[model samples]
Target chain A: MAKGTILSIDAMGGDAAPGVVVDGLAALLADRADISVLLHGNEPVLAPLVAAQKALAGRCQIIHSDTVITSDMKPSQALRRGKGSSMWNAVEAVKNGEAGAAVSAGNTGALMAISMLILRKMEGVHRPAMTALWPTLRGRTVVLDVGANLEADAAQLVTFAIMGEAYARAALGIAKPTIGILNIGSEEMKGHDEVREAHEWLRAAKLDIDYRGFVEGDDISKGAVDVVVTDGFTGNVALKAGEGVARMLGSRMREALTASLMTKIGAALAMAGLKTLRSQMDPSNVNGGVLLGLGGVSVKSHGGTDARGFARACELAADLASSHYRDEILANLARIREGGLAAE
Target chain B: MAKGTILSIDAMGGDAAPGVVVDGLAALLADRADISVLLHGNEPVLAPLVAAQKALAGRCQIIHSDTVITSDMKPSQALRRGKGSSMWNAVEAVKNGEAGAAVSAGNTGALMAISMLILRKMEGVHRPAMTALWPTLRGRTVVLDVGANLEADAAQLVTFAIMGEAYARAALGIAKPTIGILNIGSEEMKGHDEVREAHEWLRAAKLDIDYRGFVEGDDISKGAVDVVVTDGFTGNVALKAGEGVARMLGSRMREALTASLMTKIGAALAMAGLKTLRSQMDPSNVNGGVLLGLGGVSVKSHGGTDARGFARACELAADLASSHYRDEILANLARIREGGLAAE
Candidate 1:
C-alpha cells in the first residue's frame, strides 16, 4: 500500500461535477486501498454524495468551500476572485503540503493561471508546460506544452525536452525515454530557427534521455520516440487534429459496418475484436493532463469526462504524487543549472 | 473537349519515376479526352514507355531533359543547378505560357523554390501557401500553408483565408466556402496575437467567404468549415498528425481483425465494409498539394505515391487550370487590397 499520499480534488469542477466526482472517488477507492482524498466543495452538496457512496465514506474527507470556479471565468478574473473556491482550495492544499498533488477538471486557462500563481515555478524553470499521455502503438508516449504556453523560444523548447523526459520517467515509468522535437520534417534544415537551435542544444546537452534527432507528426502515434516536445500552439493543434481523425474514422467505420446486413453479422462475430478496438481508442483510458515545471504535481482532468475517465485522472495524480515527480523535475533543473545549460 | 488545356509533367520526380507518371497520364487521358500533356524526362526512357500505351502516344508531347532532381538536393542547390531539369522545365513551361499548369512529384522544398522563382507570386500576395485537399466527413475541405512558409503574420493568415476559400470554390465546387482560422480554442482569447489579429481582420474584411470565426483542430475533419487556414508550421504539424492517427487506427484495426480465427472469418465476411472504410481513409485518393498564390497553378504529387495517386495529382492540376483558379485568387486579393486589408 502507498503511504503518506493524499490527492486534493476540486469536487465542484467539470461539466458534470459533484456526482461524477463522488462516483470517480468511489471507484478509485475501490481500486486502491492505499491512498486518501481531500475533497473541496460545498459541504451541503458533497456530504450526502460521500455518505451515499459506501466505498468512499471512510477514505474521503470533505473540506467545505462555498465558491466554485465557473468554466467561463477568465484567468485574470478567476485569480482575483477565486479565493476559497473549490479549485483554488484544492491547489492550496498542494501548496501548503497538505496533499501530495491536486487534480481539477475546471477551466484550463484558470487552472494554469492559478497553478502558476500559487505553486510558483521551479528553480531555473522559465515556463510551465502541460504534459499529456498520448497512446501509441507500443504503449504510451509523453507529449508536452499541449496548451500551457502559446509560444516558446529555442531555449524554452530545450527546457520542454528535459521536462518531458523527466515526466515520462515519473508517470509512464520509462527509465530512459527516447525524446524527439516535433517538426514539419525530420531533416535538420526543415523547421524554423528556434526548432533548429533547440535541436542543436538537445544534441549537445549531456542528459539521461536518449535524444533522438527530430520526428515528424506521424511519429507521435508510431511511438518512434517516448517523449515528443513542441511549442504549445503546435502541440495543441496536433493533439486535437489526431483526436479529430480518430473520431472521423470511427464514425465512418460504424456507418460502413451498419450499411449492410452481412457486415452487421460480421461485426457481431468480431465482437471481441471490436471491443478491443474501443478500449484501445477510448479517451477515458487516458484522461489526465499534468502541469509540469511547477513546484508541486498538478493535474487537469477533462471537464467533460465521465466517472471512469475521472477515475483515470485520479490514478494519474496519485501515481505522480507517489513517484515524487516534483523532486525529480527539480533535480533535473538543478543539474541543468549547474551545467550552465540554461536556455536564457 | 476542353480547349487549350495542357499540363506540364515532371516525369522523373516521384519515387516510381516515369513508370507511375506514364501510367497515371494514361489513366487521366482515358478519363478525359480534352487535355494534352508535355512529358519532360529522358526521351529514350520515356519514349518506349509512352509508345507502349496507345492512348498516350497521340496526346503526349515529349520534352527531353537529362537532369532529374534527386530527393535529397537542398532547395538552394536545386535552385542553383536545377535549370533544364525535368522539374525545372515543367515549371518553366508554365512560366513561358506553353502549359496552363505544372505537376511534379519531386522534392517539395525544391519544387516550391523553383515555382516561386519561375511563376512569381500573385499581386498583393506576400507569401504563396501550399494548399492541400483534406478529406472530411462531408466530401473535402481545403487547408493551406501545409509548409509553404514557416511563420506568418496577421496579414499573411488573412491571405491564406482568401486563398483557401478560392481553392475550395474552384476545386471542391463550394459556392461560398465557410472559412475558419485554426487555433488552440474556438474563443477569440485563446491563441497568440497574430492568430487573434487575423481573426479580427477576417471578421471585418468584406469578402465572399463565410467567415466562421475561430475553429479548433478537431473542427477541420468535422466538416465544420469548408476552408481551414493556418500558418505553415501549425498546418504542417496538424496535417501530419491527422495522417498519423489514420495510420495508427488502420494498423490497430488490422491487428484486432486478425487476432483469432473467428475474427478472421468475420473479417472476410465484412471485407466489403472494410474496403469502403479503406477507400474513405486512403491518403492516395487525395494525393495532390496545390501551390496557391502563384500566377500559374502548380500541383505537387507525393513522391512516394503510385500510378493512381499521380493520376489524382494530374486531375487536380488540370481541374485548377481549367477553372481559372489563378484569376479567382487574384480577384479576391484585389478585393482585399481595395478594401485596404493587406496584412503588410
Candidate 2:
C-alpha cells in the first residue's frame, strides 16, 4: 500500500553484465526520488563500480552473492544450484518482501523457471505467460507466451489471452483492447485442432474483451490488434523474427542512404525522419518482457540490453507493482475456471 | 515441351476462388504467347463471362467438371473421392504427362498429399519438401519443407538442405547458395536434439555447397543465408508470418501516408517510391511454392493469388524444368547417400 521502496535487480545477468545494469540503476535512481535499487551481485565484483559513482556511494545497496547463472545453464538446474547467484538472489529479495518486484536479464528459461517455481502462479491462474510489448508502426501491441511455455493446450492459450488483455490495458493504457489469436490464417477455421478449439471457446466465452477472430504474424508490428495471443514456440519465433527483420530493414535503409553521394545528401536532409524511424525500430522503447499470471512481478530485459533497456524493465516493474493487475487477472480467471468447473 | 498446350486449370482452389482464380487465369492467358488455359467448370457457370471477354474466345477452353474440392476437405479423402474435381483432374494431367507441370491453388494439405502420392518423390529423395522463395534484403532465399513434413528427422533435414540448395542455385541463380539450419539460436548447442544433430551432420557432410551453420527464423528475411532448411512446422509458421507481416506493413504505411492533408501531397510526390515499395512487397512476385524433391515439377500458387502470381509460377515451372533441377538434386543426394553408406 505504501510507496514501493526498491526494485531488486540481477546485476550479473545479461551480456552487458554489472556495468550496464548498474548504469541503468544509476540513471533510474537519479530520475526518480521515491524508488531505490537493491543490486544483487558479489560485493567484491560490484563494489568498486558502486564506489566509483559518487551518487551511488550510499544510495544503492549491493547484496553479496557468490554464484552467477550463465546463459547456457538449464532453467530448472540453474534455479536449483545457483542459490547465491545474482538472478536468484534478486528474485529471493522480492519473495522475502525486501523489494516490490525483481528484474533479470539472465537465461530466459531460467528466469521463467525460477519465477514460476518460487513465486508460484497467481490465484486462479492455470499458467503464467511471457508477454512482450511489440513496437508497431501504429503503436505497441502485447504478444503473450513468447517463450515461457512451448507446449500449451487450449485452456492454457485462453489463459494467455486473458492475461495479455490485462497487461495491454494496464501497461499500454488501451481501453477495452481488442484481442486476436495468432494463427496460420485470419479465418476462424484456419489453425490446427488446438487453435480451433481455443477459438471456439474464446468466442463463446463471456468476458469484458473484444475477441477479434484471428490475426497473422504481420499484425504484431503493424498494430492491427492490441493483444496477440499464441503459444510460446510460435510467439518466440515470431518475436525473434520480428527483431531480425527490423534489423535487416534498418541495415538496408542505412545502406541505401550511403550507397550513393546524392542519397547520402538526401539522408542528411531527412535526418529527422530517419532518427524517428530508427527510434521506432529500436528495441529499447519496448525493452521489458513481463512474466504474466505470476503472484509476484517479474520482468526480463533482453540479454544484450544496455542501460536504457534495463531502466525500462525497472520502470515496468514499478508499473506492475503499483497497479491492481494481479487482482484484476485473478478475478477474471476465477470466473472462467468456475464456469469450466460448473460445466464439468 | 513445344509451348506446352494450354494446361487445364481448376479455377477454384483459394479462399476467393472461382472469381479471383478465373480472372487470374484469364489475365495470365492474355499475356503469355506460349500458354493457354482450359477452365474446368460447368459451361453454364462461365458462358456469360466468356461471352463478355472476346479475348478469351479462342484462348479459353472450358471443361465441364461439376465437383469442387472445398478448402476443408481431408487430404486422404480429397485424393480418394475428389476424383473428377478440378484439382484432381489437373494433377491427373501432370501424372499422365499430358501437362509438363501441374499448378494448383487448392487446400495445401490436399495438394501436397496428392503430389507426393500421385507424382511421388524423386529417386533417392526419401521425403519431398514444399519449398517457397522469399525475397530478402540480400537477394532471395529458398525455404524448404514449408509444410511438407511436420515432424522430420536429422536425415530428412539434411536431405531438405541439399535439395533446397540445389533449388536455390537452379531457380534463383545463386551459385554455391549458403544452406542454414533454422533453429532457436545460432549456437551449435541451442535447439532440440534433432536440430543439433542436423546442424552437425550438415556441417560435417562433404557436399558441393557452402554450408552456413544454423540460421534463426529472423535470418530467413535478413538475407544472412541463401537457403534456409527446417522441418515443415517451423518453415510453414515463418512463411505465414512473413506474408501476414508484409500485408500488415503495407496497410500501416498507407494509413501513415493518408494521415493528413499535407502528407497527401507528400504521398503524391512520393508516388514513384510508393509504387516501387508496393511492387517489392507484392505477393505476386514470389507467390509460387515449389514442391521440391519430386520426380516431376509442381508449383503451388497462393490460394488467393492473382494472375500475376500465376504468371510467376508458370515462369518458375519453366525455369525448373529447363534448369534440370531434378537431375542436380538427384546427383547431390546420390553423392551424399553414397558417402553416408560408405562411412557407415
lDDT of 2 by residue, A24-98 (tens): 887887777667778898799799988787656566888898888999898667867977788888888888888
List DockQ, one per candidate, in order: 0.68, 0.24
Cα RMSD, model 2: 5.4
The per-model lDDT (C-alpha) reads 0.88, 0.75
Pairs that collide in candidate 2 are A218-B244, A218-B245
Q: Model 1: how far is A258 from its true place, Å?
A: 0.8
Strongest candidate by TM-score: 1
lDDT (tens digit, per residue) of candidate 2 on B1-344: 22555465666677766666666665666666576665665568766676676556676667777788888888877878788887777777677876667677878777777778778888777778889888788767898887776567888888888889888887888777888887764222376667778888777777787888887778888888999888776677677666655554455545555655655554555454445555666778888888887777777888877767876776676566557677777787777787773121
Best by DockQ: 1
- Candidate 1's residue-wise lDDT over B174-218, tens digit each? 888999999887233578899889998888877767899888889
- Scored by Cα lDDT, where does model 1 land? 0.88
